[model samples]
Target chain A: MSARLRRLWGMIRKESLQILRDPSSISIAFIMPVILLLLFGYGVSLDAKNIPLGIVIEQPDTATQSLAGAFDRSEFFHPQRFGAIQEAQQALAERRIDGILWLRNDFSSRLLSGNEAPIGVFVNGVDSNQANITKGYIQGTWLAWLQHFAVAQGRALDLPVAMEQRIWFNPALSSRLFLVPGLIAIIMTMIGSLLTAMVVAREWERGTMEALMVTPLHMGEMLAGKLIPYFALGMGGMLLSVAMALYLFDVPLLSPFWLLMLCSALFMLVSLAIGLLISIVTRNQFLAGQVALVVSFLPSFLLSGFLFDIHSMPEWVQTITYLVPARYFVAILQTLFLAGPVWPVVLVNAGAMLLMLAILTVLVVKKSYKRLD
Target chain B: MSFFHILSLARKEFLALMRDKRSRIIIIVPPIIQLFIFGFAATYDLNDVPVAVYSEDRGGASRELLARIEGSPHFSILHQISSDAEIAPLIDDRKVLLVIRLGQRFSADLQRGDPAPLQLIIDGRNSNTAMTALNYLRDVVLDFNREWQHGHGQTGPPVKLEMRAWYNENLQSRWFIVPGIVGSLMLVVTLLVTALSVAREREQGTFDQLLVTPLRPVEILIGKAIPGIVIGLLEATLIIVLMVWFFEVPLRGSIPALYLGILLFLIATVGVGLMISSIAVTQQQAILGAFLFIVPAVILSGFTTPIANMPEMVQWLTYLNPLRYFLVIVRGVTLEGDGFALLFHQFWPMAIIAAVTLILAGWLFRHRMY
Candidate 1:
C-alpha cells in the first residue's frame, strides 16, 4: 500500500509539472471557460424588446394617425414609416424590421361605423417565438387604444376582460437568471473534458505512459492522479462562475453552497471520466481530443437543454440525451440556482451520474491496461 | 518532382488514418449526429409548454376563459392552483409555468358594464417560454371579447392589431440556424483537425523528415490546407443536403452564392487552424489552443441567440469573426430569398477576414519550427 501511494504521488507530481509548464494548457484551463461563460451569459438572449418595426399608411386619417402614434410610443416597437408596403415587406424580409403594419383605406371609417374591418399585419413567422411576442404587443397596444377611446365617449364598455401578468422566480425576465446556471454546466463540461482529454493523451504522445506502465503505479492510481488537478481547476471555474452569477449578473444562488459544490464536483468527475476514457481508447492525442469534443462538448451544449428545451425535442433525441451526463447536471444546476434542491430529483440525477462514472472509469482502466505492442 | 514519391507519402498518411478505427468513427459519426441533433434541437419555436391555471371565479365567463386556454395547442394545463401562495411554490419548483388569476367580480363586472380585471403570473426566467405563454393568453382573451360583443348585438369600434415579422416570414428557425451550424461545425472540426495535424507529426518525428525534403514552406502549407478544405467541404455538403431533404428547409437563394460565402468563410477558419498547428509544439497545445478559438467563434457568431441582443461592445467585436458574416449570408439567402445585391454587405467583411488570417498564417508557418 505504501509503495502504491508513493508511485501515485510521483505520478501526480510529474503531471502537475507538465501542466504548469504548458502555458497554453494553463490559459485554456483557467481563462477560456471564463471568457465563454461571460460571453454566453451576457451576449445571448431570447427575450428581445425594442424591435424595429416599419409601418405604411395608405390613407392619412385621425384613427390611422392615432394608431401609428400609439405604435411609435410603445416600448416594444420602434415604428418607421415607409412609402409602400413593398418597401416595408422588403425590410421585413431583410431582417431590418420585426414586422410591418399596413393601414388599409377606409380603416377609420370602418372603425367609427362599428364594422369588423381587418387590419393587415404581415409578420415573418419564420421565427415563431419572435412572431408570437410581436403579435401580442400589437394586440395589447390596439386594445389599450380602443379602451381609452371608449372611456372618452362615455359608452358602456362591452366584453370587459382584463389581464394581469405576474412573472415568478424572476419577475424582471432577466436573461441572466436562466443563462448563468446553464453557463456553469457548459463551462464545467468544457474544462473537465478539454483538460483531462489533453493530459492523458499527452502522456501517451510524449511516450511517458510506457514509463509509468513499467512502474508500481496501477491504472486506477494513474487515473486518480490525472483527475486531481482538473477537479481543482473545475471547482475553481465553478466558484468563479458563481461569483459572477451572484455579484455581477445578480442570479440568485438559492440552494446551499455545499450542495451546489457537491453536485458540481460529481459532475466534474463524470466529465473527467469521459475524457479519460476517450484518451485511453484512442491512444492518440488528436483523435482523443476530437472524440472528447464530440461526446462531451456538443452533447452538453445541444442535448442538455442548455440553450433549447429538451422537452420540446423528439422522443428519439430525448432517449439519446439520457446517455449524456451533462443533461442531468444542467437540470440539477438550474434547480439548485433558481429553486432550492429537491432531494428526490437531485438524488435520482446524481445516482445516474454516479453509475455513468463507474462505467466510464471501468472502461478507461481496461483500455489503459491493454498492451501497446 | 516524381509522382511516385507524392503517391507514397499520401498512401502512408491514408494507411495511418485507416489503422485507427476510432478516428474514422469520431470523424464521421459526429457530423451526422450533430446534423440530426441541431436539425431538431435548435429551434426557437415553443410547443406544448406546460402551464397551470388558477381560477377563483367559477362562473360561465371563467369557464369560457379556461376553455380558451386549453384549446390552444401551444399550452397544456398541468395543474390548477387554488390560492395565491401556491403560485410562488409552483413557479419556484418549476411545477408550473403560468398562473391565471380571475378575480371574484368577473361575472358581476360583465353584467354591470364594468371592465373585469384578470391577472396572469408567468415564470419569466425562461423568457422565450414566458413570452409564448403571454401571447397565448392574449389571443384567448381577445377571442372571448369578440364573442361576447357579438352576442350582445352591440357594435363598437373593434380593436385591430397590425403585426409584421422581419427576416423570416415562415419563422423557419432551421433556415436561420442550419447555416450557423455549418459554420460552427466547421469551426470545431476543421480547427482541431488542422491544428493537431502538424503537431502530431512532430510528436511522431515525421515532421523533421518532411522539413529536410526540398518541398518549400508554401508546399507544406498547401499540403496541410488541402486535406482540411476537402474535409470541411464534404461535411458542409452533407449538412446542407440533410437540411434541405430531411428537415424540408428551403433553398430559396442562389446556390452559388451560398457556396461562395462558405468558401470564403472556410478560408479564414483553415488559415487560423493552420497557424495554430505551426506554432504548437505538442498535440495537446494545438488542441487546447484551437478550442479557445472555437468556443468564442460559436458564441460570437449568433448561433443560439441574436448578435444584436449582445452588448454594443461585444456586438462590435463580433465583426472580427468570419462565421458571423457567413451566418448572416446563409440565413438571409435561405429565408429572405435575398440576392447578391442585398447580401453585398457581407462579402467584403468575409473577404477581409480571410485575407488577413491567411497572411498571418503564412508568416507564422514560415517562421515557426516544428
Candidate 2:
C-alpha cells in the first residue's frame, strides 16, 4: 500500500476507535436520531385536530341543534356548549377553547325570513396559523350545514362556483411526510457538524493537533481521515432516520434507495466539511460547538424551509435561506421521498449541494493547511 | 448553607463565563442572531404562494376568476399554461404550488346557473402550506360565488360565517412566534450555561478542589443555579426587548407576569441542565444530555405546532416540560394581555418542575461529589 493510503487508513481506524469508545458519540449517532424522530413524528403536527371550540346558542331549536351537531361531527373540532357568548369569551380568554361559534336568538328567524344570518366565529389569534385553520374549518362546517338545511327544507342549494380540490403527492395532507424528510437533513446536519467539530476541536484543545502537525501525514490525508469516519457515522444516522420514517412512521420512500443514499452521502460530505472548517477556525470545543450550532444546526432547523415555508419569508430572509446548505438537502429529500425522482428538482438541488461541498472543501483545506504552516 | 459561599461561587461562575471573550460573545450573540432568524425567517403566513393557471375557457367569468386569483396577496401566478401537459412539469418541478384549471364548460355552466367545478390541483408535499393556500383560494372562490349569485339576482347564502380573530386582529404569525422564541432561546442559553458548569469542572479536575472547600453541596447547587438564572434573565430580557421593540409585537400584559414566568422557567431548565452536568463526566455528555432534553421539550412545547395537535400521550408528556408553561405565559402575556390571575395556571406547573428537577439535581450533585 502507498504510504499516504496507509497514513489515511491509520487515522481512520483511530477515529473509528475513538467513536466506538465514546458513549456520547454512539448516542449522538444512534440514539438521538431515534428520539428526535419519535418526538417529531408523534409530538409535532401542523394538522390542528380536536381543537376545543365553544358553541353558544341563545335559542334552543332544531336548526341550532343541527348546527351544533355538525360541529360535533367534525374531526377538527371538539365543541363545548356555552349558554352565553360571555361565558364562551371567558373560555377563549383562558385558552380553554380555541374558538367560539356564537348563534344569536335571531339566527333561525333571520334564516327563515330570507336574511343573511351571520354566525359569529371568534378565534384566539395568538396562534394565527391555528386561528386561520379554525376559521376555515368553521366556514366549511357552516357551509355544509347550510346546504343540508336547504335540502331538509326542500330547496335546492345551488352555488354558481364549486371547487374540486385534488391534492397530489400527500393525499392525507399529513405534515409527517413533509417534516420527517426535512428532519433527516437536520439529523445529518447535527451528526455531521456537531460530532466532527467537537472531536477535531478536542484534538486542538489537547494539543494533539500540534503533535499530528509534526507527523508524516499530509494535511489532505488528515482531513480525509477525519472526514471518512464521521461521514460514515452520519450516513448511518441518516439511514436510521430514513428507516424510521419508512417503517415506523409509514412515510413512503418514492425515490430509488440508491438515489437517496447518494444524495444523503453528498449532503453528509457538505456537513462534515462545515464541521472541519468550524473546528479548524475555533480550535476550542465550546466555541466550535456554539459556532457549529449557530452556523449549521439552527439554520438547518429554522431557515432550511423545514418547518416553515421559504416563500412565506421576507425577501431578504428568503435570500439568506439560499446560503443554508440544508435548504438544498431538504428540497432534495422532500422531493425524493414524496414526489419520486423529478429530475429538474433533484438535479438542481444536488448541483447546489455539490457547489457548496466544493466551496466548503476549499475553505477547510486552506484553513487547515495554513494552521499547520 | 452559607449565603456568602454561594454568592462568591456564583461570582466566580460569572467570571469564568465572561473570562473568555469568545465564550462571552457566544452567550450573547447567537441568541440575537437566532432571534433575527427565528423572527423574520420562521413564519407560517404564506405571503406569495406560486400558482399556475390553465384556463380552457376564454370567457369573461374565467378571466374574472383569474384576475381575482392574481389580485389576492396570498398567490402569485407564475405560469399560464396552454396545455394539460404543461401542468405536470410545473407541479412536478414545484415551480407552482397550485394549478388553477378552468374547464372549457366553466363559463357556460356558470352562465346557465349551474355549479361550475373549478379544478384546483395542489402540491401536497408540504401539506400545511398547501392547506393554507387552499384555504385562501377557497375564500377567493367563495367571494366569486357570492358576487356571481348577486349579479344574477340571487340572494346571498344563508348562515354566512363571519370570523373575528381576537388579540391579533391581523393574525400576524410573528406575534405568536417571537414571544415563544423568547422562552425557547432562554431555555437553551440557561441550560447550556449550567449544563456545562459541573461537567467542565469535573473534566478539568476542579470539582475535587471545590469539594475540599467548606462549601456544602446545597451551596454549590445554589451557586451553579444562580449564574444560569442571571444569564437566562439577561438573555430573555434582550430577546424580549427585540421581540417587542424591533419586531413590534405588542407587550400587552403586565411585565411582572412575564418575568415571573421567565424566572420559573430558567430555574426549571437550569435544574435539568445541572442534573445532566452531575451525571455527565465530560462536556460532551453534558451537551448531548442538554440536547436530549432541549429537542423534546421544544418540539412538545407547542412553540411551532399546537399541543392540541399532538397525540394524547405526547400531550401528556408535554406537561412535564417547563417550556410548555413558559410558552403559554410568554405568548399569553405578550399577545393576550394575560395578567397574573390568568397566568397563575401556567406558573405553578413550572414551579413544581423547578422544585422536582432541582431536588433531583442537588441529590445527584452530592452523590457525584465523591
Candidate 3:
C-alpha cells in the first residue's frame, strides 16, 4: 500500500473504533433518528380533529337540534350542549371547549321564515392555527347543514359554481406523509454535525490531533478519513429513517430508491463538511457542540422549511432560508417521497446541495490549512 | 450543609462560566439570535401562496373569477397558461400551489343558470398549507356564488356563519409561536447548562475532586441547580421583553403569573437536566440524553402544532412533558390574558414535575457520588 493510503486507513480504523466504543456517537447516529422519526411520525400532526366545541341552543326545537347534531356527526368536532349562551361562553373560558356555537331562540324562527339566519361561532384563538382550522371546519359544517335543510324542502339549493377539487400528491392530506420525509433531512443534519464535531473536538481536547499532525498524513487525507466513517454512519441513519417512513409510518416512496440515496449522500457530505469546518474552528468540545447546535442543528430545524412553509415567510427570512443547505434537501426529499422523481425539482435541489458541499469543502480545507500553518 | 459552602460552589460555577468569554457568549448570544430567527421563521401562517390560472374559456365569467382571485392577498398568480399540458409543470415543480382551471363550457353553463364547474388542482404535499389555501379559495368561490346569485335575482343564502376568534381576532400565528419560543428556548439553554455540568466535571476529572470536598451531595446539587435557574430566568426575561417589545406580541396577562410559571418551568427543566447529567458518564452522553428529552418535549408541547391533534396514545405521553403545561401557562397568560385561576391547572403539573425530577436527581447525585 502507498504511504498516504496506509495513513488514511489507519485514521479511518481509529475513528471507526472510537465510534464503536463511544455510546453517544452510536446513539446519535442510530437511536436518535428512531426517536425523532417516531415522535415526528406518531406524535406531531397538523390535522386538527376531535376539537371540543360548545353548542348553546336557547330554544328546544327540531331545527336547532338537527343543526347541533351536524356538529356532533362531524369527525372534526366533539360537541357539548349548553342551555344558555353564557354557559357555553364560560365553557370556552374554562378551557373545556375550543369554540362555542350559539343559537338564539330566533334562529329556528328566522330559518322558518326564510330570512337571513346567522349562527355565531366563537373560537378560542390563543392557537391561531387551530383557530383558523376550527373556523374553516365550522363554516363547512354550517354550510352543509344549510344545504341539507334547503334540500329537505324539496327544492334545489341554487349554488352558481361547483368546485371540483383534485388534490394531487397527497389526496388524504395527511401531514405525516410530508413531515416524515422532511424529518430525514433534519436527522441527517443533526447526526452529521453533532457526530463529526464532537468526535473531532474530543481528539483535539485529548491532544491526539497534535500527534496526528506530526505524522506524514496530508491534511486532505486526514479530513477525508475523519469524514468517511461519519458519512457512512449518517447514510445508515438516513436509510433507517427512510425504511421507518415507508414501513412503520406508511409514507409512500414515490421516487426511485437510488435517486433518494444519491441525493441524501450528497446532502450528508455537505452537512459533514459543515461539521468539519465547525470542529476545526472551535477546538474545544463544549464550544464545538454549542456552535454545531446553534449553527447547523437549529437552522436546519427552524429555517429549512421542515415544519413551516418557506414561501409564506417574510421576504428577508425566505432569503435567509436559501443559505440553509437542509432547505434544498428537504425540498428534494419531499418531492422524491411525494411527487416522484420530477427531474427538474430533484436536479435543481441536488445541484444546490452540490454547490453547498463544494463551498463548505473549500472552507474546511482553508480552515484546516490555516490550522496547520 | 453550610450555607457558605453552597454559596462558594455556586460562585465558583459563575466564575468558571464568566471567565471564559466564549462560554459567556454561548450562554447569552445564541438564545437571542434563535429568538429572532424563530420569531421570523417559525410561523404556520400562509402568505402569498403561489397559484396559476388555466382558462380554457375566453369569456367574462373566467375573467370575473380571475379578477376576484387577483384581488385577494393570500394568493399570487405566477402563471397564466393557455394549454392543458402547461398545468403539470407548474404543479410538479411546485411553482404554483393551486391551478384554477375554468372549463370551456364555464361561461355557457353560467349563462344557462346551470352550475359552472371550476376545477381547482392543488399540490397537497404540504397538506396544512394546501388545506388553508383551499379554505381561502372556498371563501372566494362562496363570495362569487353569492354575487352571481344576487345578479341573477335570487334570494340570499339560508344561513351565514359568523366567526369571531376571541383571543387573537386577526389570527396572527406569530402571536401564538413567539411566546412558545420562550419556553422551548429556555428549556434548551437550562437543560444543556445543567445536563453538561456534572458530566463535564466528571470528564475533566474535577467531579471526583468535588466529591472529596466538605460539601454534601445536597449542597452540591443546590450549587449546581442555582446557576441553571438563575441563567434560565435571565434568558427568559430577555426573551419575554423582546417577545413583547421587539416582536410586538402583546403581554395581556399579569406579570407575576407569567414569572410564577417561568420559575416553576425552570426548576422542572433544571431537575430533568441534572438527572441526565448524573446518569451520563461524559459530556457527549449528556448532550445526547438532553436532546432525547428536548425533541420529544418540544414536539409534544404543542409549540407549533396542537396537542389535541395528536393521537390518544401520544396525548397521554404529552402529560409527562413539562413544556406542555408551561406552553399553556405562557400562551394563556400572554395571548388569552389568563389570570391565576385559569392557569391553576397548568401550574400544579409543572410544580409536581419539578418536585419529582428534583428528588430523583438528588438521589441519583448521591448514588453516583462514590
Off by over 4 Å in 3: A369-373
Comparing 2 and 3 on DockQ, the stronger one: 2
TM-score of 2: 0.98
Best by DockQ: 2
lDDT of 1 by residue, A25-79 (tens): 5676668767887787777776666778788898888778887888889888888
lDDT of 2 by residue, B35-122 (tens): 9977998888997789989888999999998899899999999888899889888999988999999999999998988789999999
Interface RMSD (Cα, Å) for model 1? 2.8
**Tens digits of lDDT, candidate 3, B82-112:** 8989988989998999999998999988888
Tens digits of per-residue lDDT for model 1, B1-370: 5545555555555455546777767766887889888778776665667777777777887787778778787678888878877777777656677777778878777766577888877776566667666776777787787677667665644755544455555565666667667778877877776787777787677887887887655566666666667677888888888878887777788888888887877777888887787788877778877877777788888777777568888988899988888887777677667678878888889888778766777687557753
Q: Per-prediction TM-score, please?
A: 0.92, 0.98, 0.97
Q: How is the predicted docking of candidate 2 categorized under the CAPRI scheme?
A: high
TM-score of 1: 0.92
**Model 2 regions more than 4 Å off:** A370-373
Give model 1's docking category: medium
Give the Cα lDDT of each candidate: 0.76, 0.88, 0.88
- Computed on C-alpha atoms, the DockQ of candidate 1 is 0.56
Descending-DockQ candidate ranking:
2, 3, 1
Tell me which residue pairs clash in candidate 3. none
